[model samples]
Target: MMTNAIIPLVYGLLIGKSNDDYNQFFEKLFEQDNFQPESIMTDYEGGTIKSVKEMLPNVLHKAVWRQVQSKGLATKYREDESFRLKVKKLIALAFLPVDDITTAFDLIVDEFDEEADDLLEYFGKTWIGEPKRRGTGRKKPPSDHKL
Candidate 1:
């Protein structure tokens, strides 16, 4: 899998970090080397995710542990083994069958305490839509499991 591969194909300064910047970078990479990786990984950057989906629609997009840092859970992930495990469990939810993610997410979130409320809310809003102020069941999720 691309995740386990040893590859660092590019390193340079970016004028900015935006959907436009990433899009142009990817376009140039393709123009120069005709490069199109099987997959790309990111730290939960919205611009990167948007560009990857736009330019490399056929390629897989994966998120690494940097999600912890992005969500301000770095200290908790490092010091609290239980929270770390729960976070890993949440990440693991990505590998589950798409139809099964909601159930698995609910199961993992059940173990979270108030410390994880914001993280849970982040996940709920980003990957799975939260319940409405008034609803019988969950709203249709905003992000697909692929995210």
Candidate 2:
């Protein structure tokens, strides 16, 4: 996402099932006209994280809790009054103009440190190259997958 100089802009949510699939998606994103962002905030997906670090090392990265809140199971923060109020505050904080995107991210990170830490720890344990069994050689049909 492109943003005015006063605020950070974020774009795209291309999820993939494998590292190669994720790489191809990011390649497409990079091909869009001058789509280089100064920073990107994303969920802690291993393939995406690896791709971003390797492909855009200079960009700032901030991991957000919304990613975890939305994964696997449905999240009900939207239905709870206090949670809704907290989300409203976060949204307002996110949109406030800052000197740069980094500052904006720092604000976000600071505001949600507990949630962010939980997400980071979860990511570190789940996605960072821990050993796993390779399944049988049957490949799933493309139509059956979304990522």
Candidate 3:
């Protein structure tokens, strides 16, 4: 297997991780030229997402992943083999073609136990915005391709 190292072309420090700060930083980075990136991968950070949407509207911006520990699922992920594998299956949904993702997500979630509901809810709300209250499709559905 091959691995890629992520190196930043531009780097800097910002006082805060708020939308304003990220907005300003992105603005500065792109203001000078019509530089458009093909896509951007960012951890699930609200401010960063907002900034990217505002600053680089045409570029594809994806929320890659949220921290498993932060979601209080680390223990399950560490010790419960079945739970861990299910979580990984959730993550693998990211690689599916955009049009097929909703269906694939439904199939994956059908296998999860009730204990994984919270994690599933978080993922559904964050990445797959549908199957919401009014639409009523059911629950809906991240990750490195090679993981």
Taking all chains together, each candidate's TM-score versus the true structure is: 0.52, 0.34, 0.47
RMSD of each: 10.0, 15.6, 11.7
The Cα error of candidate 1 at residue 11, in Å, is 11
- Report every candidate's CA lDDT: 0.72, 0.48, 0.66
Write down the worst ten-residue block by lDDT for model 3: 138-147
lDDT of 2 at 59: 52
lDDT-based ranking: 1, 3, 2
Candidate 2 wrong stretches, greater than 4 Å: 1-15, 63-147
Pick the lDDT winner: 1
Tens-place lDDT per residue, model 3, 11-122, is 6577898989988888787776866775676656778866776676544223323445666777877698887777766656655766776778788889987877777877
List pairs with backbone clashes in candidate 1.
none
lDDT of 2 at 131: 24
**What overall lDDT, based on C-alpha atoms, would model 3 receive against the true structure?**
0.66
TM-score of 2: 0.34
Task: Give the RMSD in angstroms, all C-alphas superposed, for model 1.
Answer: 10.0
How does residue 41 of candidate 3 score in lDDT? 64
lDDT tens readout by residue for model 1, 56-114? 75552244344567777788777998887787677666557777888788888899988
